[model samples]
Target: MARWKVNLAVLCIGQFLVMSGMTMITPFLPLYIQEMGVTDPHHIALWSGFIFAGNFVTSFFFQPLWGRLSDRYGRKVMLLRSSFGMAVVMTLMGFAHDPTQLLLLRILNGVISGFMPAAVALISTNTPREKSGFAMGMLQSGGVAGSILGPFIGGLMAEWLGFRSIFYVTGALLFGASMVALFLVKEKFDLAEAKKKTNITIVEGFRVLMKVKQLPALYGVTFVIQFSMLAAMPLIPLFVQDLHGKGELLAFYAGLVGSVTGFSNMIASPLLGRWSDRIGSVKILAVCLIGAGLCYIPQALVTNIWQLFAARFMLGVFMGGMLPSVQTLIRSYTPNGMESRSYGFNSSALSLGNMMGPIIGGALSGWVSIRGIFIMSCIMLLGNALWVRRTLSDPQLPKQTIQKAGSASHSGDDT
Candidate 1:
């Protein structure tokens, strides 16, 4: 098999295993906190917030650092470290006797869960330029699949073996994936290039970020894009229950809904990527944002589960293109030699969005109706579309450049 394919396989397996562990915790976490002998509603709410937000809070700080480290050290080493660290943190969460302990562990887990960006950097660095869009789309789809699967499996396992077992299982899977990474994954890092690094400080990453003109627009678009996309996530299970009516398999149904979105991502991601190659990433992303905006409106109107599913599916299709386009755009924006660190900044944008999205979604859901959240999501997406149209350049490669780049691919080595 080609090196790119091998890398994809490795990433996909690891993503699935890790995601399965994560999903197992998502739905049951509140219950787990409650079971920890917490009786007060306010305390439970605060504890829940700490549990969920803890990892993201630390991750937001650590993600860029990890990205830079991956660039300086090796993405492979970072990947292994993240996987192993997640295993330890997750396992510890299983053993926590109180909500406080769990909260601390979650925070620790956040600092360690920097693996995703590292994996992305690894694959993006290795991918042939001609196939970057497709490759990125594929890798992201793997993550989506894991998100889809996590909640369902987590719910089932939590019920069957108890909440604590879910953590144990999740830890084992991640630990096993770490072992796979250490033994099976091989990478060639540039010692001369990495070693020749000048006196670049960690603070300098912020300066580098400020100096990149297009990066601000990219960051803005990313924030709005994820805000729009994840604005519905916090309400999904509730929506499912409302539309379908509660059942013995409520969590499973919720998982099914989540998985359906991943299913759509799997179907649409590659098509969007290949299409982006032909027409340009910017145009496709523009259309996707517009379509996604429109799709959210239908969700506000849907009364039944099937309609909700259709709306989510359409939203997924549009979203599938968004990240790949952003990744391709980041590559286009950064100097070729700085691809690793440039990607680190891009990853930071994504991590920030991920951290903020659920918080905003939850607050919106609390303040307004779930239907109102969809309207807000539409506005956010449309706003991003307009912003991108005005500020960002089209991502189309020049014809001569495409021909030269494509010809070079035939000789091997994208760089």
Candidate 2:
């Protein structure tokens, strides 16, 4: 394999471990909170949302900081920081005596959550511009695959080894990932020049990056994509229960309902990513947005679990195209030395969406029901597609305008 491909392959595994370790507690978070002595049903619901969103809320603010540092120093160091930091926090979660302590640790997890962004920065900087879409899609696929398995493994472990033990297992997995990255990932960064150019104030950096007129729109697209997808996620188990409540089949169907989308997303990401490389990411992004929007309509109307499965599978296929396309577009629009920072902002947009989507969706479910949330997601996504059609006129920048993901130093473009 080529050097870039090798780097990509390593980072792909890191993304998988990072996502799996983080999500390994997903299926039983509420139960874990209950175990921590919050007995009321209402408290369990509230604490679950709090614990889940806290990391994202902190992540929304902190990811850009890591991005800036990665651009200044090197991407690999930041990846190590995130992986090790999260490993520590994951293990600590296993020891929490109460929801308060667990929530605080979750917030700390968000503080160090830049493994994917750092990985993306590293890959985008090194790979040929034409191949960025494929790299990103592959990385996303790896992460989604982990997410699909994490819950299943967590459930089984919760039965055999208990919930806290699973946290320890997650920690070990993350530590293993960090060791892989430390040994395997290589970069050709110029440290002295990177430090020299890294003096721009955070305010100045933000201002300079915003000068790329196309970026803000792309960030919005990223936000809507995550928000639309995740906002509906928390409601799925309830909807599955509504569809088929056959005791053991109920749990199985609910897990299947969620996992199938990710499974299809894993299948579609690389395929759509390769396609995006040829035709430009904007067209793929727009069509996928519209397709995803339409796919949700069937989901909103599905009376049977099988109908929901078909719609979700199709939705995943469309969703597979959205993020990689957006990331590619962001790379295309970003200034050379500023690529990592731009990605940071993009990740921040994603974090914000991740934090707010569930809160709003959960709130919406109270008034409109689960079906209504689906309809709402459909409308928001189609509206975003229209916005993309009107607002984004991609600079049509030439493929030859490749910039290394280093600092303002252009002398080391030898990679």
Candidate 3:
């Protein structure tokens, strides 16, 4: 296999481990908080959202910093750094004596989080442009598979052992992933070239990127997708409970309902990714946005857990195409040597969405109903789909123009 292919495989495993470790505790966060001595339901809900949002809040600011650093120091090093740091933080989370400690640790985890984005940057920078869509799609499946399995495994482990043990397991998995990255992933970073370009600041980098007409719009898609997808998450368990009428196995059933979409996403992402490579990423993205928006309608109307699962499964099929297509478009629009920074900015956009989505969902749920949040999410996605259609419809810029701009910007003093 080609070196890029090898890197892709390593990244896929790394992404899987990172995502799994991150999500393993999600299904049981409230229970864990309770274990830490919180008795009030309102307090538990507040802390849960705080701890969960804390990670993305820090991540939104730090991702660009890490991305810029990756451009200079190499993406592989950043990947290892993030994974190892996360391992340590997760292990500490297992030992936290209170919700405050866990909350702080979660914030710390966010501060060091960039493993998946680094992996994406590495693959995007290394893979041949023609194969980028397929590669990104395949890479996305790793995260999806991890997400699908993580909560299920966490739920089982919570039943068998406890929530603290899940953290230990998650930490160990991250450590293992870091070791794998150290041994297996390779990069051809030009340190001298990077050193020569150290004068360019992050602000300048953003300005340069925004000069590209398609890039800002692509970043908007990133935010919209994450925001819309996550808007349904905070309410899923409650919805499951509503559907199932409360049982001892409520957590398990809720976990199943939560993971069903990931199962379909893992199956569909690579296929849609490859198809997008032949047909057009933008076209696929537009279709997926519309399709997923439509799927959310049925989810809002579902009468049982099975119906909700079926709706989510269909939503997954549409959503599987969304991120890969967005990433592919990002890869296309990014200038040659700024891949990491571009992906980093995109990651920040994603983090912002992650931070805001659940809050919006929670707020919307309180104001109207859980079903109303689904409808709201549906509207956002459909609106974004139309925005994408309008914004990305211009004729492609000539390759020579992009190459010229890339060369000038990367030559060390041109910020």
Error of 1 at 74 (Å): 1.6
lDDT of each: 0.76, 0.84, 0.84
TM-score preference between candidates 1 and 2, better one: 2
The digit string of per-residue lDDT tens for model 2 on 1-415 reads: 8889989998888888888776777779999998888899998988987887788888888877887788788998998999999989999999999999999999999998998888888898889988999998998898888888877788889999998998898898889888888998888787776766655545556656665667777888889988888888889999998888756788778878888889999999999999999997888999999999999899989989999999999999999999888888877777666667778889999988887788799888989988888888899899989888876664565232222222443343211
Give one clash count per candidate, in the order shown. Answer: 2, 0, 0
lDDT of 3 at 273: 88
Per TM-score, the best of the predicted structures is 2
**lDDT (tens digit, per residue) of candidate 1 on 42-71:** 988888877877876787777767766676
Q: What's the lDDT for candidate 1?
A: 0.76
Query: Over the full model, what C-alpha lDDT does candidate 2 score relative to the true structure?
Result: 0.84
Query: Ranking by TM-score, best first?
Result: 2, 3, 1
- Candidate 1, residue 186: the lDDT equals 68
TM-score between model 3 and native: 0.90
- Cα-based lDDT at residue 361, candidate 3: 78
- What are the TM-scores, per candidate, against the unseen true structure? 0.86, 0.91, 0.90
True-structure lDDT of candidate 3: 0.84
